[model samples]
Target: MSWTTPSDVVALLRKRWDAGAYLGRPWEPVAVPLRGPRPGELADRFGEAQDWVRRWEQVDLVRLERVRTGGRVIGTNEIPRRVWIDTFEGLCALLRVGPAARRFEHLLELTGRRFPALTGWVTAHPMKTLEAADDWERLLAVVRWIETCPPGLYLRQVDVPGVDTKFVERHRGILTELLELRVDPVDGVPRTDFAGRFRFRRKPDYVRFRMLDGSRIGGFGELTVRAEEFLAPPARRIFVLENEVTYLALPETPGAAAILGGGYGVGVLERMDWPAEVELVYWGDIDTHGFAILDRFRRRFPHVRSVLMDQDTLLAHRVHWMTEPKPTRQPLGALTAEESALYRDLISDVYGPAVRLEQERVRFSAVRRALGP
Candidate 1:
């Protein structure tokens, strides 16, 4: 005779078993419910199913015996003992299924086999912590954003609800640390005395020079001077150059001096004190970035003017123009009407985004011509 399938017997036994446990004695076996379809109905439905039904009854008896003896019969030993459920009723309760329902044995076993892995996954990627749930949610949100958005696109689009610009600005450092993104710091001019002697002990690439004070001078190669140097006392006319080479090579301007305005170093420009009579002229590339820097500088010093940065200059040096990977969005802050129009056309790629007339690209004679005798 062919062996009967267990599913049929299991179904019959489930119909016969009492769902609820006896009060104060849940381990004890209770009589099966007789009101449901009897064993004959199951036998008729499942062909040649007698042995399967018998085996199910025997297994149920053994399970009850194990529960009564307080022997481990369900779940893994590695799981916490406090959460272990012994009886079928207890197992069902833990699984959030009906109590003592024998048909669900297969489901219970399946869950038992798969639960540890599920728990492990949750633990590895926990969305909640003791401190707060919001942090976890925020982290998840960032992950989702990155997954959905293209690279660098998220940086330009800012629309986080309930998060104000000031809040973002205040937590800018923390956000950068978490997301591993860089944001430029607010700009201000460096103090001349401090700029003259300041040197970053940790970062060898950064050096401070006192632009205002003429006392100390070091860093023979390309250097980054603070804004204070240009704005502080002895506030001579300031000549800002985008190229380090051009800045270093600047000939003496008698009473005028030069500064290396590191691209996007406008954050440093806003903090310096300018002399009432001192004039500031920014000379950067004829590219989007150069004009952007010029615009930013003028915003800080409205009287500041652009030098060697015009369409004519760009056209004349078309042969030397290099490509700029990322262009600006137009003159940023308070640019003059003409400067604004020029910046819009440049940034819009009317002359192509890659078009860049670098300051260093300009001939020394052109620089002299722009500076004038």
Candidate 2:
């Protein structure tokens, strides 16, 4: 017969006890006198004695067996008798008592990995509920905060609740230092220090010259001019030289200065604050990149003028003409009417793309003549 009701459960418990089936301790059966109808009645019929049913342990069904010793049962002779079939419904009823019933939902939600730690905390503080534990509150707070903010803004500014400006100030320095160390994936350099001070400073070889009034003047120290310095009044008469060697060789005028345009430092020129009445002039290769730089410069500073960057100069040095790999095809911006027409004819293939006249290729005498006698 299928084991049902309290009586059957008692019988099964007794059989298991007799068979020495229990693995823990010397099994002992304690007689619990039934004061009312069996626990099963209240559990199945009225639910009035549900707590008694949940707390009921079938001691009689799983009684301890005594091994024979002489004529009496010895202290070491006890063992469990046999297996007691525990139904799932009975197990569920047993677990619904006190704290276990209260924490049933939480138990169901815990994973195999998390259950042990949670159970340990519950065991250590039996008076407190699992939800009242420190770990639980911290975990909940973190989860709620994360739901509001994602991880991508780890170093970004955030306004967290209960976090004050003082707290931000405390960690701001450390956070900034960490960000400074992170290199750009594209260029593999600390992004914070990228595009830093491109210009270098060096003392120039002093050379004094007599002024137009025959008065002796002292030469100034070589100042490696940057875009900011180039914008100053002393550098108002801006002279751009394409060749570095020629730039170094040029004599400085009292108020005028030269820039070693470094090919593309022309772009840097766009950022400088030039003087309102400054006379700006560019001297580049009589070729495409040079003209393109001139074009770019004029676009930024429309008042800028080209010096000795002409077809006549290119033709005069025809013997020194060299081929350029990539010639400028796009029309320059803010070009003077004369420069626009001249540049068109030069790149039109009427002259040929191979035609190149670098400024450095021109003789010093030719440059002096172009500048002025």
Candidate 3:
């Protein structure tokens, strides 16, 4: 009654085969012993013994271990002790995964001949290899291109036939693992961003800013400059805010620059090379995520100050308070003493869970007051 069926043994081997263990170690022999009904269980479920025989006969590819057991009514009888599938072929046949297994075998054989260094990788990522089995040819084609092509080319610049930007981007994750195995150390910076790590040209990052006091920018009121080329103006102040409306409506202040579009993008500003002592002000919503962003922003730009993100401002805008569905509870190590106290209150739900005040909710007069004369 509690016997492991023929289908169950096949399912078990199918798992291992799909996992790539079969081809991962090509020289190693395969052996899986099925756990069938014990001798005592067989005699107890003698009524279903005929059904067991029918299931056993169906799995003709596997070798069986049999035993003689006595039942009160059936007398001494021969039954299967366990089933052994010792060969890869037999396991594949029983599981009916022969086609997939054969493909994996071919892949292993080809890797051994063409890319012997990937032997360890094949052993480590059996499942990944199987998932990419269908795409293995295209994937290897890209790998081969990376190996031969000049370093620092953009993904699109890869001149390999049938290998395009989308093809490489879609397979970046696995390619990174595979690329690292074959790519020269001089060409790879594994610790950097994807483009840098693989020595490819990444899409350039740009800084969008508004010249607060003077129209030093060309054409438009705002200037969007590539982060690498954007020279920081020798202006006395730089104000960064998240809200577009507030950024656009900012009243001109002498010797100041307004950086719009805020979130956890302070890292991107690192390339801007801002002056060490200039007045840097950040204005964000009076919420957990806002403070969290400000907290991270300060780590890189420690001199950066908060303008309207204070307890007084939060209390003044209670009418505009809204729920922050998923608030951050981690301490903002970069916050000043006062700001840290307010951040604690919001997260602890002293005002209640998810309480927040958007920077846009504050009056323009309040903004001017915070910015100062």
lDDT of 2 by residue, 138-179 (tens): 333332343355334432234555444354344333323322
For all predicted structures, in order, the TM-scores are 0.44, 0.42, 0.88
Instruction: Itemize residue pairs with steric clashes in candidate 3.
Output: none
The digit string of per-residue lDDT tens for model 3 on 62-152 reads: 7777777766766777777677776777776777777876776787777787788886787678678778887787787788888888877
Off by over 4 Å in 3: 27-44, 71-75, 112-116, 123-126, 185-192, 215-221, 271-273
Candidate 1 vs candidate 2: the TM-score winner is 1
Q: How close is candidate 2 to the true structure, as a TM-score?
A: 0.42
lDDT-sorted candidate list, best first: 3, 2, 1
Worst window of 10 by summed lDDT in candidate 2 = 194-203
Residue 157 displacement in candidate 2 (angstroms):
22
Candidate 1 residue-wise lDDT, 1-373, digit = tens: 3333334334544443333222212354332221221234333533333343345445432232111111233222111111112455643443334532432333234323533222232222222121222343443344334334443332324345545445444444333333322222223523322111122111113222224233223533223543334334343676767677777777645456566667776556566665325787788877777777777677667788787777778778888988888875643767667666767777777887667788899889888777753
lDDT of 2 at 227: 42
Q: Which ten residues in a row have the lowest lDDT in candidate 1?
A: 75-84
